[model samples]
Target: MADRLVPSISLKDFENRKGEITKQLLDAAETAGFLTLVDHGITVDEIEKQFALSKAFFDLPAKVKSKTPHDTKSNNGWEYKAQLRPSTGTYDQKESLWLQRGSQWPSDEDVPHFKDTTTEFLDKCAKVSNQVLSCLAIALNLPDDHFRVANDPNKPDCLTQLRLIHYPASENAVGTWRAGSHTDIGILTLLFQREGEDGLEICPGRESHSSFAMGDVFTPLPAHTGPIVVNIGDMLMAWSDDRLKSNFHRVRAKDVGKSPSRYSIAYFNQGRRDFVLQGPLKKYPPVTVEEYFNQAVQRNFARQQAATA
Candidate 1:
């Protein structure tokens, strides 16, 4: 794997350091399309607590998890090895629990503090996302609230999502990818990985490269405590007149033998269903969030796994 430097930004004094932060963010968005954040308000204890809760939930019996089986229409609940990516042309080897505002959550008895802790964490994620989006807005010479207003999760029929995914320990099978190379559909994706669990990879030349072979070059992003990794996605790429790039990324086990199990928390910031999406420069035609979502789903169906186990 080629070693590419993914910039790290400090949100310690976000308000006072807009000039510095905005420069860092603009460079990252245009080139790397990925960055790490520190001092973003959420603490190490909070992150670890969420990891524990996720482990508890994933440890439940398959039948129990089936109570909230993944729905293709609404996109909530549990799914196993069902994420088929166009890049890999096969399923991603993992299970995930999607959490939305109205998502079916496990009881406190099933996973103590699952709902409460996650809801709290989700709000924190939103605040951090907005901070970054505000910088991007400034980079484009738009109002700071431009992206925030369109992506408010509290709005009705919003599609914002938080996913708790588990990659069970398994053989490092040849020609298999934990997550295939692909770009996110939403505006931004904030990923929280458990300490010491590392497997994410991001490719370079994202804005120019339209096709990738299995042997394409990539950079591996390691996980650690107290830092949240952020990736710009297709939504921002289009909204920025292709000036801001959304890169392709994947997850691959670093071990060549029996890979260890991995856990990750991902928050997707989506535009509200009723919001109209059109770049200020008219680079792309205007389309409502509802219309964009329907088209995206048809192009890339969220194939639910046959079984939970």
Candidate 2:
């Protein structure tokens, strides 16, 4: 089959259109497991502005950018060519800054208004994520607030992650990957991609439950549209009893020789660390958010080590 586009749903009349949007989202989530969202309230200009800010930070001298230093415990700060994935047994060809609570950030003098603007955009993204989560709750025959209650930011325990990634331009050599194949580790991931900087591809799963493996055929998703690409994540899949798919995706280095630098942003919507997550179907044992994250990280690293060995 030819390359396909992931379903693009709108939040134009969110309250009134909730049912319509929910069905589309639910169908996509169950099958293809990926989709792009439009009318999400973030303007093109605002997204572009954030992209420019991302570029500014990445353009800073190596020492300046490295000052904040990525912390594994907090999972925040800057790292370059550091994410080695299990699928390819190689470091991802990118540098990224991960932002979350208690993160040590660059000074405002270094990047004027960076923190203020990024935080503001994060709020907008969170709002969109909550709307989707609420709809998914309804689709799953649960209370509309089921997901939101766990992810409420005002509860003082809610924690989320926002990452800015810069994939430098380089030779499109064989055996290299911009971002190796992997599934996201949260409830949902809202991704903002630079227009026409396409390399993203997904291999939609067709099975009873989620597992990681390399697949031959994949579909290319366009990075040209204004909509933010949203993918169902592992936590959501578990919560939905594997009814929601968490497909594998990657950024291939295939045309990098003709491509420019790629900058992307992702907002990972997660719940409080202490929230006990148990789906109504109980396909998996109940686990706290904090415990789940640690388990997922360990599984990934073990797989990577085994692959390399």
Give candidate 1's TM-score.
0.92
Model 2 agreement with the true structure over 1-309: per-residue lDDT tens digits: 212448888999999998999998999899878988889899999999889889989999999998879998888899999999888888998999998755787778888989888878988988999999999999999899989898876565676888999999875544367898888888889999988888888888645334775467888786864788899888888888988888889997665355567888999887889999878888789999888888888888889889899
Q: List pairs with backbone clashes in candidate 1.
A: none
lDDT of 1: 0.82
lDDT of each: 0.82, 0.84
lDDT of 2: 0.84
Clashing pairs in 2: none
For residues 1-309, could you state the per-residue lDDT of candidate 1 as single tens digits?
A: 222458888988889998899999899888888889898999999998998998998999999888878998788899999887766667899999998988788888788878889989989999999999999998998899999999988877778999999999877554357898887778899999987777888875766222233337777888787788898877777778778877888998755667689999999998888888777787778888778777666555433232222
- Where does candidate 1 have its weakest 10-residue lDDT segment? 300-309
User: In model 1, where do residues sit more than 4 Å from their true spots?
Assistant: 1-4, 208-215, 301-309
Model 2 TM: 0.95
Top candidate (TM-score): 2
